[model samples]
Target: MQRLATALQIEHDASLRTLNTFGLPAVARTLVRIDSARAVRRVVDHPEYGRAPKLVLGGGSNMVFTRDVSPVVLKVEVRGRRLVEERPDAWIVEAGAGENWHDFVAWTLAQGWPGLENLALIPGTVGAAPVQNIGAYGIELKDRFESLSTVDLVTGRSVTLDARTCAFGYRDSVFKQEGFGGLAGKSVITHVRFRLPRPWQPVLGYLELERRMHETGNFAPDAQTVFGWVCDIRRGKLPDPSDVGNAGSFFKNPVVTVEQCRDIIGRDPAVVHYPMPDGSVKLAAGWLIDACGWKGKSVGRAGVYEKQALVLVNRGGASGAEVVTLARAIQESVYGRFGIRLEPEPVIV
Candidate 1:
């Protein structure tokens, strides 16, 4: 434990705002920051601390800490990247879990790697990306996901899990579920590997992206161009944490039955829906929030972002309780009005 303290910052009552984008003023019981996997394993396996619950933290961009965190906080700082293998059309790149996701994308783009260009500017770490299966502009993390290595907290053993074993689907993974007594929260991700396309074709499935590509006349946009467009769109639409604290897209788009969607559409022809392959329909969570008149609605310091209804912003001097309350109100209102319950995208810690 003393060696662990010497290797990293072991702070008591650390302000969490500096770590998380939500800007909530919460404190950690024991925050341990580690820069390498070796240090991470060392701290977890320390004999002095036996069976203490631990929380794995990354960029803290996509999570909302609703209260003072229990257990020890393991702030992953592992960082590095290198091309492990390459083919004519693609390369296998391994990145430390704590590496900034956007920086990795930029680095890959500069090196002429193309698969991650469309995912540019997303806030968080490489480790957190796989947990959410993050997607944007018609691309998903799983599409390029090769595998990842995680440290099993119970046994202090490192394990490598492939794509199929990950059980990734719609922003979820095996780590998020529990098959045993209650739920197990004892796994910590250490690193992620991505199998990226080399001469990548920019995905243009999102209508906004297609429109922008058309506007630029770069019909076959390369990685840089696609990256630029994604950055532009994200910057213009999403609120920067520095200016207005927020977790992008507070709720996921609810996938409902076709019959349910058809009933809603029958009542209002303008109801927007995206057809899914499994005969379900994805309804716009933003539209439902806007319909409930929650967009830009403020309660104390928490409010729906003025620009994007799907995002909840912290306007300074707000408690986590206020934000959660506002979110619940919005959820209840949407369910009452449309018979659909909006699910939050950010993990509530």
Candidate 2:
């Protein structure tokens, strides 16, 4: 390994205001830019930081920094993308952990790959995608995930993990857990591989896509069309982080038992819900927040989005505390009415 001092770009007291999508005020006491797996190994072996607590940060799209960071920040910037292999059954594609998730999806489609169209325009980096098991519309990252390479934070050893080992759940993976065998805060992902099957079939029938098809009179939309529609729909519903400081979706839709769903529906007949295959019902958190009269509501410069109640936006110069306050208020209201606790989607740092 190269000398740790020579192989890394280390910064002190770095401003993280712009790094996070929420634009929350925070500073990293020591921030290190890691461009490769070797660089991460260097960080692990370096005497000055090897034993210290560290935080791995990607595009910061899925984070809300509440205060100045104390742990050594590993800003992963490893970059690469390629077709690893092609077979009769599937195409193996790979991307550096640092690549933008949305851009990578578009690149895959441009190269004639179509499996990732349903996930286009989601925020954050490819490395972060597996950590969250990100999903949108009718597809989740785990559906196409093959494997990922991660470097141990303590030993500098690299290991590749597949979907089964990842233990994916709703917007979750092993990387998001720290109990028992969880890899959370223990390793840094350097690259990811995806398995895109051949003889592509578009994943349609999603409510928004169905609406687009109905309006356009084009029922058989291609991958590009699906990608375009997703992008357009996202633009219309979610606030762009650049224009308004906000993480895309602030809360995950709460899942409930069939009996619980019936109880809530009895209270509010218009409650929007979907019956999951597992016999559970997924309630729309945005609708719940809106029903609680939180839409366009503000608490100390942090507010629920008027256009989409699922999002909490920084109304300009908002602190992370204020955002959390607003989120808690919304959560309490939803729980009081529906008896379900709404869980936040972003990682609060």
Candidate 3:
């Protein structure tokens, strides 16, 4: 495909190594950067590309590409952020789907918004957050979500969907679902609004945060303080992609029933687990992998991060298949020992 003198930026046989955080090698046959909502409509109307399958990409922080892509890659580059409204009870903020999530959180704090403090330093774009229902410490995006606007791929129609319409769950949303009425691959999220509640109380529920508070001898901390602490904690634990390639956490913390939790506890008293409000138990996947003696272990160029067992890092020039292989071996071992299946957090492409 040749470039046309149009608003859309198109590239054929685009190298995806630098695009993905893991630095996995892959190529897109046709890659188009969509800077605005209108770009999506234009894509649907393109002469040669119209009717072709599409794959939407954000920061590529949460995806692992194992092979070259055949679908047209729509790299979302939409940008903007603003204060939507300020009520007595809460403050509403809106951000483009393509905006860097961590930077957006920092901007909110600089503007005196406090609700997103716990989620500070998380990777990926604001658009990907809702799709993954990204969470950290004690708060999930749904806890602060207001609504989002998206453009339909088939009809090029725009619509705003509330939390219910998104059907958010643990690291999932309607955008990640593909059953009947599911929105995955059928729409492009252009903008997302977050509802930051007023009179913010610090979320010190997580063990690491509590340790930080105790070590600092400060029971009460501000939002910026919390933000700094979260960033520090993340930096110390997870390897920076600029230094070492990684896709953050590798697996979702599996949630099991209370009875099932007891069964695991009976076998291993030292298993790291958290009790949920609804009587379920969330087991730490990192702990499970570490207990199985997989931390700092490697299969080819892909290895688990020594500092944080949750992260799988690309040691030098690692391939996506190596990462997947390492992940599968960890899963099989964990299932053999704990009888719990670990689901990968990254989208395997």
Against the true structure, whose lDDT is highest? Answer: 3
Can you write out model 1's per-residue Cα lDDT over 181-255, one digit (the tens) per residue? 311367778889999976676788888888897898878877788889999999998998878888888999999
Give the better candidate number (1 or 2) by TM-score: 2
C-alpha lDDT (0 to 100) for residue 149 of candidate 1: 87
Taken over the whole model, the C-alpha lDDT of each candidate is: 0.83, 0.91, 0.93
lDDT of candidate 3 over 245-290, digit per residue (tens): 9999999999999898899999999999999998899999999999
Clashes of 2: 0
Backbone clashes per model, in order?
0, 0, 0
Candidate with the larger lDDT of 2 and 3: 3
lDDT tens readout by residue for model 2, 231-253: 99999989989989998899999
Lowest lDDT 10-residue stretch of candidate 3: 1-10
Regions more than 4 Å wrong, model 2 = 1-4
Clashing pairs in 1: none
The whole-model C-alpha lDDT of candidate 2 against the native structure comes to 0.91
